[model samples]
Target: MKKDIEIPKVEDISVAVVKEWNDEKTEEVFNVYLINLQNKQIQNTLVTSKGYGENQSTGEKINTSVLRHFIGDLDAKDFAKIEPIIEEVFGLNNEYWVSFFQNNQMYDKKFIFLPETICDENMINVPLLNKKGVVI
Candidate 1:
């Protein structure tokens, strides 16, 4: 008898958070990366990101910073990175929204950085969404 096997799904794109440091390692900057993991290129890509947090006294969300980019084409297995202002997106209560288009299809993904994830690691891998609203 043959046993059934499960195949894992592969993602075409990925988003990640990285830290850039100066020579002394004391100065650092936070960055976001959009990577194309597929074999083919993605065309007419646009990326917009925003960071927000809930108010301490009011329970209302507030915007911290906004970032946007447009790329004609992103080559296969390549990536684009944006370095946001460190103070805008580094707070413990902050969350981010990253939206982009690949091959004319839109993908929007939200990421929340837990204290442990960013504090202990130099790089943190975030999630990406596909056209069907599925995490890729």
Candidate 2:
């Protein structure tokens, strides 16, 4: 029965890891952002993120604490800062599960950044934010 349920596809929205100047404007910091590129607005947005991976040297499994953020509403062609990400977790799998309602319909999707996928080699000009980072 689960397969019979209709699940609408989430489109035009993206999660990006951005590199930005620190508050003092001295150094750069990495942050996560939720971008909504739809033609309409989304409400009651909830985003949860976590990181997990294996240590190459010790072969140890690693997992970070899950953080949940509630973004009340997001306007069309806009973006909201989800959280600040420490560079140490760049070697892990960063996963973000986002849920929101648009036009009275609910939408959900999982956006993930694989280990080391946030490197400079994969950086791009993220829309709306206009910053350099990897988008999922």
Candidate 3:
């Protein structure tokens, strides 16, 4: 006789872009953070980030930054901030791609930034699950 077994998959991982303003709030910088929402820990993680600027009329894409980092272990309900220097003028047709791995499994999320998101809001909450979760 054969017995059936179940396997578990890694989930509950997310990313965020944090912004900081200067004394007069004239200049700002950004940081990317990897959030683990699960109760357990994930090991051997790698996070990669890239930015793109798209042309609405011509349909052309431009590369902004190609960043990669290795996060050894991530605790439960914790987060890891990857790189701390993001300088980009996000227009209406700009987007970001952030990919990562957890225990040999790969997960990724993308964020499309509009002019209103940056100009109106102070902190941009980028969710790690899907497009919507990361773009808010």
Best by TM-score: 2
Minimal lDDT window, size 10, model 1: 127-136
C-alpha positional error of residue 121 in candidate 1 after TM-score superposition, expressed in Å: 4.4
TM-score of each: 0.58, 0.97, 0.57
> Which runs in model 1 stand beyond 4 Å of their true positions?
1-10, 22-26, 57-60, 85-88, 92-117, 121-136
lDDT of 2 by residue, 18-80 (tens): 999999999999999999999999999999999999999999999999999999799999999
Candidate 1 has which clashing residue pairs, if any?
none
Which regions of candidate 2 deviate over 4 angstroms? none
lDDT of 3 by residue, 17-74 (tens): 5665645879876655677888877777676655556666797777766666888788
Report the Cα lDDT for candidate 3. Answer: 0.58
TM-score of 1: 0.58
Expressed as tens digits, the lDDT of each residue in 15-131 for candidate 1 is: 556555656889875555667778877776666666556656787877755566775577887877644535444554434454555655655555555433454334434433121
Please give the distance, in angstroms, between residue 36's alpha carbon in candidate 1 and its true position after superposition: 1.1
Which residues of candidate 3, in runs, are more than 4 Å off? 1-10, 21-28, 55-60, 85-89, 92-119, 122-136
Clashes of each: 0, 0, 3
